[model samples]
Structures are given as structure tokens and as C-alpha cells.
Target chain A: MSQPTTYSLSARIMHWGMAFLLFSMLFAGLAMVQSLQPWHLTLLGLHKSFGVIALIAVIVRLVIRLRTTTPALPDSIPALQKRIAHASHWLLYAAMFAMPLSGYFMQNAAGRPVAVFDLFTLPAIMPVSLPLYGFFREVHALVAWALIALVLVHIAAALHHGLVKRDGVLQSMTGRKK
Target chain B: MSKKTPSALPLRYAIIIGAVGGLGALVFAVAGGLGQSSVTAQDFVNLQEGGNPHLGFRRAHAKGFCVAGEFVSNGSLQPYSIAPQFTATSTPFVGRISIAGGNPTAPDLNAPVRSLALSFGEGSSRWLTAMNTPPVMAVGTPEAFYQQIQALSPDPETGERNPERISAFFAAHPETQTFRNWQAGYTPSSSFASEIYHSINAFYLINENGDRQAVRWAAMPTVSNGETLDAANANALQDEFFARVEAQPVAFDLTFTFANDSDDETNPTVLWPSTRRNMIAGQIVVHQAMPESEGNCNEINFDPLVLPKGMAATADPILRARSAAYAESYRRRAREHFLNSSLQPSPQKESENNQ
Candidate 1:
């Protein structure tokens, strides 16, 4: 069976860019939390800034998706696999947007300026509240780990389709066999 | 299933974006906006440097502490200590120079860090704490700052700084390179007084007109101006500070140079190029001295949050965080001292042994 034509050039670019961004952000976040030298602050700032960029890109990508249809999965693929793909995609969207927002809220709640690179500042959207701050912090932390787990699962599923299943699902996203 | 795509977002979307952006910018302008809060040297000296209202002196006091003193350096041998009530007045202030640690005779270059404080007065209002480091740190997050401290502490197994671990951590986190440049010739364990510079991480000041500004308190040793530590001149740094205090009690003055928000923001690190543009606003004098025999040094609480009007702390997140952390650390140290009793040896005893 043949694979259908896949994502547009713009969609593919946004997808891959967002992927690289999200993964780099995850590592940078981990490093920032793990290190404390004066420079780690730079890392945290970069992480946050990149996270915001990914989020914006995600929004634009979503808009593009709404304006242009994505290629459908192969009919031969199992229904369960399709459902997993759909759920994972939505989860990535949620994470790409939510993580940056959570961090922004966290800094704002602490009365800190949210600098993307110290280049431009993002305005605070919420007032300071210890309880709400704590809630967002917990969510931010849990979401980070959840995102990590989900990304790992994503990698595994993609590999299963590409290697074990030798299916075109993974290839479609990568634009390798569309 | 493949579905039909929707059309692009309408021009209304761009209008919505512009309106949102415009409204946000306007509100920021009204609220002093982005530029309003960027702390200037004038802000520090003029004492107009307001903090996040939710976490200012009022909130800090609600959480259990208040700004007790604002010691501004008048560029004299004597620095003045302004109480939260004192304003627009300048006088000679007392300054104390010492080595902080378990032992008294240790070399200054042995330590990777040094702290210098100018005690502007004889009582609770006397202290302005500064480190011998430069360029403010980048770790804006409180949690990251704390974790970094633990990582830098003496190794649990070796009872020493684990070089491999420290090196790896430094390599992994390259942001420490600036600090590393400062620490290259210095050791992690030494008498602080012997170092060429003494600093206060976040210090603020007030001017003649009761205006406030944010400042870093630095003491450049006339004798030990270079990075390399001279064992011979070690005593010179301490002796000069004490001799001047002993001669006139009011002889020495502490000076403070203003750090505008722009310069501060650019280099948030301690290395603010002290030699170049930093300005000295006021002076302080030493009236009376506290002997190691007084035994009250342990009870002393040197908090940067204790600013007077005409001298307000900036919204510098690190300053805000450190004020709370320092207070908590001070409290915890006091509690530990009370509980252990023998945890810290007397500096007098150590000094006598060296003699």
C-alpha cells in the first residue's frame, strides 16, 4: 500500500522546529534546575525564551493546520494506533503551550520580570498569590515530567512504526516517505 | 480521517492582536510599565526604587522583618548610617574589615570567596555586607540558587571540595565562567580581609535630596589591589581599617557608587566595572568598635533588606530572594548555635593560638 501526500512545507518546518525546540527546552529546564552558578540563570532564561517561541510557533502551526488538512494515516494501520497518535499530538500541543505559560505565571506571581532573552519582556498576567503560585509550580513540575514521558513514548512509537512495523506513520511526520 | 481545512484566520485576528498589544503596553506605561521599573542609579540613591508591592518592605515585614538601616557611603573614610527615619543627613560611619571563618590566621587567597562589611555605626544599624566578587549572578530562580550552594559545598565523603565534581559541575554549567575568572587565583578557604576587594551583593543609597538608588558596596584595598594574594600585605588590609578606626573612630569613610538599572541589567553580575563609571554618593564613620571579646557578633543580624528611605532595594529578584534567604539563614544559624553550643569555636581562642 502507498502513503498519502503529507504535511505542507510550512507545516513540516513548524513541526520539526517545534520538536527541536521542545526537546532542547526540556534539557535546558533540567540543567537550569540542576545547576546554580550565576550562569544557570542564563540557561533558565534561554529555556523560558525558547519555550515561549515554541508555544507561539505551535499556535501558528495550529492555525495553519486549521487552514490546511493534514495527511491521514494509512487505512491498514490499527485503529488503536491512530487513537494513540491523536492523543499524543494533542498532548504535545497542550504541553508546548502550557509549560511556558506556567513558567511565566510562576515568575509573575513571584513579582519577577519575564525576559525572553532580556531582549524583550513578557508582561505579568497574574497577581502574586502563594497558593496559586504553588499550584502552578506543582503543575509546571508535573507537566515537565509528563511531557518527558510522553516524548519518550512518542519516540518509541515512532521507532516501532519505522523499524518494527516498517509502516509509513513515522515517515509521514518526518517527510521521509510521504 | 482526512478532513477539509478551514480558511485562514480573518483580518479581525490581527486587529485583536494589535488591540491586545496596545492595551498591554498602555497599562505597563500607566503602572510605570517596562521602563518605569528598570532600576536606575537615581532610583537607588533617590530611594524611589520601589519593589513589587506584593513583596516589598510591607510584605517582607508581614513575613517577619523590616528595613532597619540604610548606610550610604559619602566617599569618605567615614560612612553614615541612616535609620529608617534619618534622611538627607551625612556623617562619618564606622567600617569593620575582617576575615570570616573558623580560623583567624588563614590566608586570604585560600578562599574562593570573600565578604566585606562596613559597620556604619556601633549598634544594630552598623553593617553593610558585601562580597569581593563581581557581576551579579544569573540564577533568578530561588530553587536553582539553593541547589547550586549544596553542589558547591565540601564533599560529604572527602571532607573537601571535590575537584572532579566541582569541575564537572562547572563544565556542565558554563555560566560560572565569569566567577571562575575571578576565582582563578583564589582558593575556597582563606581570610577574607586579605583579598583585594570587599563587596555587598545588593546595596542601595540615598542622596542629598532624599532620592534613592540601588548600589553594590565595594572596598578596594589600597594595598592589595591585584588578584594575586600577598601574604605580607594581608595584615595591611586589616591594620589600615582598624588603625583608622582607632585613631579617630570617625576617620574612615565608606563610599557607594550608583548602579543604574541599565548597567545593572546588562551585567547583573558583581563585576560592574567598579573602576570606571560607578559613583560614590555618601560617606559613613565608625564611632565605636565591637571587640571579639564583646561576644555579641554572633547575635548581629546583617540584613540588606534593612534599607532607609532615600535608599530603597531594587526589584532585582536576587536581592529580594537573598533578603529572605539571608534572614532565614541567620535565624537557622542562631538556632543551631543555641542547640549545639560548641559548634563554632571562639575566634579569640584561634587568634591567641596563632600568637
Candidate 2:
């Protein structure tokens, strides 16, 4: 058995799809807070919808990742770099789930409806508790900022592997050859 | 070597970390006291205490006059709501028009916001609605409103707003800038009858099918916009409103605008777009304006939460907080009125006692 040269097609699609969704959610979240009119509401809905989609997508990605064999890092890669990559990937998965779940809980605790695209509504599970609502809201905001930072670091590492290191590590996810 | 079938150890670690992270967040929130309790009726009372000096006047919109009118429904509101006022051909109404601030003697032209509060129906089934000239609320939440009042209140030592304190508050809550900007842009209407007033809180309108839709309403002046008032005149709006109504009737089309998927149901500060679907439910025709001393408006609380069937309040915290605050203000004013009557008799009453 040999190490694979590239990621599976499904993995690549999920990676790119989530990248786009996460970035859009970040931008929309920031804009919504500043906007004082109908546009803010529009951005908020989009952000929530995308967040839910990301949560589901991350779960599927995790399952596929567990099932599929991944390409091993090049032998020349340092142990510290490998460890950092593993830790960041795990943290990203944690954040993907945390953001949407926190938002949903916050909305429920605030006694508000969580509608999906305004087509249907999710039942409020948490009792109306402002303390709980505030707690979750703060968590959601802090986690989002942390997620943004982690994503930036991930991009930098990928670019370093692709551009400076001239390694196939980046190509595994991008499906591009060195 | 094969990639060891992507060891489940990492997956297990990921799940463990995620759970730990979530648990840690809750612990931190509780420990750090980030979970402050919700705004209460006492907070509102404290807010009024900081800003309101006139005990008998409203916390805001203290200067006002009452008008007797009737609402003539267009019969088009059945599709949106089944509220009896919207269904009736004509429902008698008593309304008050007011200028924002706690000082009953505050010059009308200096008031940044104007308001209208109306009650439809003659008895227990009455529907009350309160509206203001601003299309959207200044603050989004009860907490923010409390902070705003504190920031705007005069300093105990200086008897003036502390510039640094107010600026810090604005910096912390930039959303309040929208309200300030709206106020800065306002041009005072010559008379209350010519100003368009908006119900900033989003409400749920239930139709005959029991299906609910979110909406915000506005009373659009049927009369054309009045000339901008001269700021030097202290009682220009009231004088003009009285003279205008005496010479001719004034009216407004009670219009409801449906909320779109993008409209926020919980935040009153976010104004729905003008492009949203709007329909005129009825017309409010004011036939007579009585002097403030003779008017029932002074006694009426005009609470916004007093809703009829087929209409419901949204989850907006600011809207919910308003009911509590209004009730508190009403209680205080009523108590003050009773005390004043007992301590100092009116001129007529004093003369009668002597005779």
C-alpha cells in the first residue's frame, strides 16, 4: 500500500464548498451588525442559513475523512509542522459546529424563532433566559473571531506548502500538481 | 506504508475537544458574569428617574393635545388581519399628538421626534397603537435603551450631559448612530396632522386562516406635507394643528407593510425596506381637537402592548420593555395627580370652599 498523491473527489468538493461558505458567513456576520436597515436582516438570514449548511457539511466531511485513506505528508516535513496542521484541522471542525449551534441556542433563549430561509421554523428548545442568551451570543461572537484567525493561518500554511515549499501537501486538497 | 486507515483516534480527540470547548465556554460565561440578567421594570423606572423631571407628564412626548376622530376601514385588511377595527366600516377613535421629551413646556420645534397614540373602539375591546415620526426605533434592545438614557441624562454634578460619557456610550453602541442621524435629518412639520408616523415595532398580523405574517405599520398623512415650522415659536405646532382642524378636517391612511424574508422580526431598529408590499387598512379622520385641559388624552396611557385579536406583539425586547416602562410612568403620573389634588386645591375649588 502506497500513499495517495491527491485527495478523493468528494473530499476536494467538501473542502472548497466549506471554504466559500465559511468566508461568506464571516463577511455577512460583520456587515449585519453595522447595517441599520432591511439589508442587515437579509445578511443575518443568509449568515444563519450558510452556517447550518456548513455544520452539516462538516459532519459529512468528518465521516468521509474517517472512512477514506488520506495521503501521507512528505517525509521531509517537520514533526512540529505536522502536529500544528493536525491540531488546526481539528479546531476548525470544532468551530464549524460551535458557531451555528451557539447561534441557534441564543436565538431560542432570547425567545425568538429560528426560521430556515423563512420556509420553515425550528422549534425553540431553550427556555427564554436572557442570561443564557447573552452567554451563547458572546460565545458565538468569540468563536467566530477565533475561527477567522484559524482559517487565516490555515490559508497561510497551504500557500507556504504550495508556493514556497513547492510540495504536494497543498495539491492533496487542491488537486493541483507541483 | 498505507495511511493507517485514517485512525479513529483523531476523530475521537476532535469530539472530545469540541465537547470540552463547549463546556468551558459555559463555565467561563457563568464565572465571568457575562450572563447579565435581562432588563426589568425597575431598570425602566430608574431610567425615567434619571431623565424625567416632570412627574405628571409622560416620560417622553409630554406635550400633546387630544383629537376625536373615527377610522373608516377600506375592507382590504381582511387578507392581512381580522382585527375588528380593520373589519368595521367605521370605528370611533380618540388620539393624542405629542412632541418627544419629558417637559410639557418644551418648544415644539426643538423636539426631534413627534408621536401619535390612538385607541380604537369604545369599550373593553379597544385596540391601542403608538407611533412616532421615525420609521425605525433608535435603539435595538431594552439594554441599549437603558444605556442610552443613562448616557443622555444630565450629570449630577454639572447638570449637563457629560460629553465623554455620552461619546463612550455611542462608541460602544454604534447602532445608536442611526437614530442620531435620523434625528439630525428631521424637519419639523408645521402641524401634527401633516407628519407621517411609524409603528417601529414589528407585529404579527393573523388573517382569517390563522396564518400569521410579520408587519410594521405607518400612518401616512392624507394631507400634503406641511411647511417647515419656525424654530423660534414655542407653541407653533399645537396652535397650527388646532387652527387647521377647526378650518378643515385632517386625516391619515393607516397602512401596513408586510415584512419580507430579510426583515428582522426581533429588532425594531432595523427598518423594513420601502419596496415591501404595503396596503392601506383604513383612514383616521380627525374632525375636532379639544384643548389639553379638557381632553381625555392626558389621562390615557395609550400602551402599545394593548392589542386586539388577530394582532400580536413580536419578540423584540425593546417592544416588550416598552409596556413595562409605560405602565410604570402611568402609575407615577396617576399618583402625582392624586397627591397634587389633595395638597393644593385648584383656583376654582379653593374659591368654592371659601364661599
Query: Evaluated with TM-score, which candidate comes out highest?
Result: 2
Task: Give the alpha carbon lDDT tens digit for every residue of A52-135 in model 1.
Answer: 787788789889878877778778888997898898989977887788888777656543455565466676677644334445
Give TM-scores of chain A for all candidates: 0.90, 0.94
Residue B63 in model 1: lDDT: 15
- Give lDDT tens digits, candidate 2, residues B200-269: 8989988889888999889999776566666787778887888889998898999989998888888887
Clash count per candidate: 64, 0
| Complex DockQ, candidate 1 | 0.02
* CAPRI quality level assigned to candidate 1 from its DockQ score: incorrect
In model 2, the runs with Cα more than 4 Å from the true position are A1-178, B1-39, B122-124, B225-230, B342-355
How high is the DockQ of candidate 2? Answer: 0.02
The parts of candidate 1 lying over 4 Å away from their true place are: A1-4, B1-63, B67-199, B202-215, B218-355
